[model samples]
Structure formats: structure tokens, C-alpha cells
Target: MLGLDKKDFTLLLIVSALVLLAPLLLNPFPEGSAMAQFNAGYPDLMQRFVIFGIFAIGFNILFGLTGYLSFGHAAFLGAGSYAGMWMLKLLSMNVIPAIIFSTLIAGAISFLIGWISLRRSGIYFSILTLAFAQMAFVLAASVLTPITGGETGLQPALSDPRILPEFLGGGSVTADGNIPKPSLFGIEMTASSEVAVGNWLWTLNWGYYLSGFMMLVAFYIAIRIFRSPFGLMLKAVKSNQQRMSYTGLNTRPYMLACFVISGMYAGLAGGLMAAMDPQVGAERMQWTASGEVVLMTILGGVGTLIGPVLGAGLIKYFENIFSKINKATLEVWFGVFPDWMTDLMVTIVYPFIGKGWHLTLGLMFMAVVIFLPGGLVEGGQKIAKLFSRKKEPETPGGEAKPAE
Candidate 1:
């Protein structure tokens, strides 16, 4: 069976439980507690962590398994977001159809791009994909203004027309002259708040939970793909393309399949983002976003099942949380030191730690590349080995051996 061993399976379950319960644990401190500032229980950020986790996992399947480094993945993700938003505008707010349609659209787009890009391998393929993505970004920004909403971006408005229940007061009456945001069944998905620890705080509302649930589903699907026979075939293509060709196997179709599948995953993540926020912008498909996914996969640990999730969490943490910390906050922390020391420390570390969180991330990436080329997972394994070594038995020859 293509599955984890007992220990690994148990570990996965424990991790899943921990993730699911994170909000409660993180929010346990009272509102006025000093540690409350560090709490990360908000639904929006948690949802993003998982949503991007799915994105990174999908990217890893292509880059990690096939050795194909795509620099245009955000094209598919942005495409999916647009497709899903259109569905919300035209049809019911149910996420099922939105996700399905978005995935299909993303797969179709990826297929076309892959067909052309796969004609060349190595840097040529990367350049082809990059060019296509840049074209997409520009088109979304300009030519498709009517559909894409141009620079201001597309957002949910009550002006949108709904087809069903028009005569029964359930459909497009234009009463308020504003299009209502999409909803699941009858539950509205706008931003909302809740009281936690006697403090009023913003929660994910319905849309965030819906997005989180979809992320979990995406994660499960990715896990299945990682264990599937098709995945094995893709890995084979990655490992020895020449050998596979000599064995009469056509590798192009397999590579294309992998590319499409990965694109669909990116699309799913994009769809969820749109579903939660009901907005689509050209910037989402930019090459920088595509490079972000690459960073996520490499930093987390390519080829390992859970590494993408770790990488996604790490990057998202930096993007959302760390970037929000500014020089003023540093000044507050450094106020405890002598005047000269405070000024010196703030001047020295401010550039990299505050708004320049990306600089720190870059340094981290370089360190990982230099010392732990396999990424964080390899570092974790090395730590585990170090701890386990002490328990190992010494053989008669003075070499370490199994304890038993």
C-alpha cells in the first residue's frame, strides 16, 4: 500500500489536530494579556497559511518530482481566481461549483501553456513560461479591463444580476442598487467579528471558514496525488527521462499531466482566495507571486509531503505578520537600552528585521541552500539523528549500532 507507516500516520493525525485547534490555543490569553500581541489565531491569516500550503504542495509535485522549475505558476492561480469570481457573480455562491469550474479553467490554460513551453527544456522552457505569464499579467491589467476590472480590480457588488427567483423577490430586484456579496445557502460571507476572551476581535466569518475547509480538502487531494501511480510515473520521468524514453515511454504526456495537475492545485488556492474576498486583481498573477511559490517549496523542503506546508506557513508568516512590524515598534522595544545603544541597534537591525523582512528571508534561504540543501525537513532529520545518537548502542568494534 502506498501509505505512511504507523508512526508517520500517527504523527500526521497529531499534526492535523494541532492545526485544527491552533485558533483556540493561540487565542487563550485574555485580551489585555501581554502575549496577546503575538497571538495568531485570526481566521484570515490561518486560512492563508493553509491555502498557500496547498499551492506550494502542488508546485512541489512539478518542481520537486519532475525537476521542472516553473516561473509562471501564478498565471494559473490568478486565472483560477478570475474564473471563480465570475462564477460568484453569475451563479449561486456555493463553493463547490466555483472551485470545480476554476480548476477546470486553470487546467485548460496550463495545458496550452505546457504544450508550448514543454517544446523546450531547461532555461528555454522557463523563459517561455515567464513570457506567457508576463503577457497574461499585462492583458489582465489592460486589454481585459471590462472583464478583469483593470487596476481597481474586480470586486463583488450588488449591481450584479442573478438569474434565479427574480419574480419571487429572491432574484435581481436592484432594491438597494448594490449587488449583494455571494453566500452559501443563506449564510452571508462578509467580514464579521466575535468576542474571544471578553475582547471583540475579527474572526474569519463564514467565508474564511469555507476557505479553510477547502484548503483541508485540497491538502487531502494533494496527499492522494503524492501516493498515486501517476505521481510515481512523473517521478520516473524526472529521475531518468532518457531511460524512460529508451523503455518506450513517452515522457511529454506525463510531464504535461503533472503540469496540469499542479496548475489545478494552484487554481484551487486562487479560487478560495477569491471566494473569501470576492476580489480579483492583475497583480495576483505577477511573476513575483510565481517566484513566491518557488521559494515556499524550496524553503519548506521539496519532495517531502509536509515540507510545502511548512514553507508556506513560514513565508506567509513573514509576508503577513513580520512585514507589519515597523521601525516604530522597534523603537519601543529598544527604548529599554541606553540612548546610543538603542540608536545603534535600531539602525543596524532595522533594515533587515522590520519592513525588510524579505531581506531576512533571503538570508535564511541562502543559509538553507548552503547548509541544508534539502531544506528544513533535512535540518529536522539531522536534529532528530543527533538526539537519537546518544541512545544508540556501541558495538564491540566501537561503532554505533542498533540498541536492540
Candidate 2:
């Protein structure tokens, strides 16, 4: 189905189901409930979930399959965001053109960077990419102040001329003199519909749906690439680039292509981010931003099709949900206990949440690395294996039967 084998097609369906049903899945608690604070069905965090998922998915193509760990991939994301912002400012408030331009610009930048960085493999290449990213960051933050808005950042302005809207028979400026929000034709990205079921509330966001759709497409494409000869070549490069070189095979082109494709994915993610918020900052290109995606990929399960998406979702959940758990919130949860007990409980768990969520993430990462090197996916597989082993029937000689 959809050019995918049974397992891959099943995986695709599962992902699709998850993305489409995330609102319900992420919001299991009733509205106004104490646990409702952990609900992630809101548009902002949901959008981040998919946007970063796309970013990590792209990074996995390079780092996961090809063994090329880029320490500066966020440069492409930041570049794409800037490009998208420019599109919003100069062109119509439509997101399509901005997204297209973002991908193209990021691809071009990645091409230039890859052309130079791919010359050296391993740590040398990583350092080169990092240096270029740092240079880009500095330029965007300072040297390119006029264009990037310097430290002030870039966002839509009320007075700027949006030529496309004028040609489309609409005035660019709002009658209220407010900046226009990004949209698909007339549907604003911030627009959403809400449905109330009993005590539960669900928000269906247009922007999130759009981003989710793009993520689905991106995932499908990644699956195709992973199953193709190109993906095998990338795996080979990871396994032994020197061997392929000895066989007179030119591998630089493949590496560059993979790098550009990955950048395009990151670019699309950045573009969607701008479409949702219509803002750009030089901080988007920081090395920490790049490292975050690497961590997402590694934590989710690098080299596996669905691993990065899981990782991205996990990290975003920690960032959004766990980080929001404060003393007051914890006090409320433990309110039923004695005052001393509540205070003690808060003290015990305080360090892992509310401004120290990174500690929890670090601990989880360490556990994954030391125990399950394959990430959460491997952990899941091990659990499944255990259950399956228990389910197997015993043979006549008191041994488990091995049946096909």
C-alpha cells in the first residue's frame, strides 16, 4: 500500500492515526481537573510536537542512516525561518509560498555548506558544519542586522507593503491597523474550532492540522528514501565510506544530496513554525538548537523509522508538561496529604520538575544510553518480546514450543 510493504504500510497507518488523534490522546483528563494542566492538546504545543518531529526526522536521515552527525543543522532551520518571515513580510500572508521559499533557501544553504563540509568526514566535518553555523548565527545576530532585525528579531509589521495581497484584490493593511496573521488562503493559522464532550474540551487547530499533514508527507517520503537504493548507499557510507571509495565509487554526491534533503526537511519545519507564529530570531540557529534535535533522534532511537518522531514528542512533552510543574501545582496534587508530608513530597520531587526538567531528561537519556542503546523503540521491543515469550505455549517436554 502506498508503495510500502506490509510492515512499513502498517507503520504509516499507525503514525497517521496518532497524528490525527493526538488531540484526544494528549488530553485524557477532564477540563478544570488538576491533571488537566498536563494536557497537551492545545495548538501551540501540538504544533511544536510535529514541527520538531519533522526536524528530528530530517536529522535522522543524516545522523541516523548515514552516521553523519551534524552539529549545525539548526542553521538551515533558522535560515528557512528568516526566509519564511521575509516571504510573509514581502509577499502575501499566505503560508504556501513562504513554506516553499523556506525549503528552497534552506536547500541552497545546505548545498553550499555540504559542498564544503562533505570534503572531510567524521569529527572534521562536524566541526566544519558547527563553524559555519556559528558564523551564520553571528551574521544574523549582528552583521545582518538590517535584514534580520538584529537582536530585536523579525516579525510582520503593519506598514509593510504586501504586494501579493494587492494583486489578489485585497488590501494588505487591516482596517484596524493590526498586523495580518499567516493563513492558508482565508483560513488563519491561529483559527481553531472547539468541541466539548461532557467535561472534556478538544481544540482542533487549522495550523496544527496543516503542520501534521506536512509531517505525514515528510514521514512518507522518509520511508520511501529509507527503502530505496539511495538509503542503502547512505547506510553503506555509514558502515564503510573508505570501502566504497576503494571500489572507485564516488560517494560525495550522495552525501551532499542527503545533507540537502535533510536541510530541506528542517527548512519546511522552520517554515511551518513561522507560519504558526510569523517570527524569526537568530537564536534559532544556535548550536544548542542543533544539539536538541540530535538528542531527540538519539533518545527516540536513531536509524529507526519512527524513533525520531517519538523522541521529538517525548522531549517536547518534557519541555512543555514537566517544566510547567511548579511548587504550587505540586502542592495541589499533594494537598490531600498532611502539610508536612506535602512539603516533604514537594521537596523530594522538586528538583526533577519546574525549571529543572532537564535533569529528568538527562537521567532518561542516560538510562536509554546505558541500558537500551536502541532508544525507546528498543525498550518497547524488549517489552513486547517479554510478553510474547510469556504467551508462547509450552512443549510436551516442558520447553516452550517454537512454532512458525
Which one is best on TM-score? Answer: 2
Per-residue accuracy of model 1 over 14-79 as CA lDDT, tens digit each: 657756665665465567654466566677777788779879988998888888889999999999
Residue 288's lDDT within candidate 1 is: 97
- Candidate 2 lDDT tens digits, 153-232: 99988776778854431346776777778888878899999999999999999999999999999999999999999999
Q: Report lDDT (Cα) of residue 312, candidate 2.
A: 98
Q: How many backbone clashes are present in model 2?
A: 0
Least well predicted 10-residue stretch by lDDT in candidate 1? 395-404
| Candidate 1 ranges with C-alpha deviation above 4 Å | 1-8, 26-29, 165-178, 191-195, 198-204, 391-404
TM-score of every model versus the real structure: 0.88, 0.94
| Global lDDT scores for all candidate models | 0.78, 0.91
All models, RMSD in angstroms: 5.5, 4.6
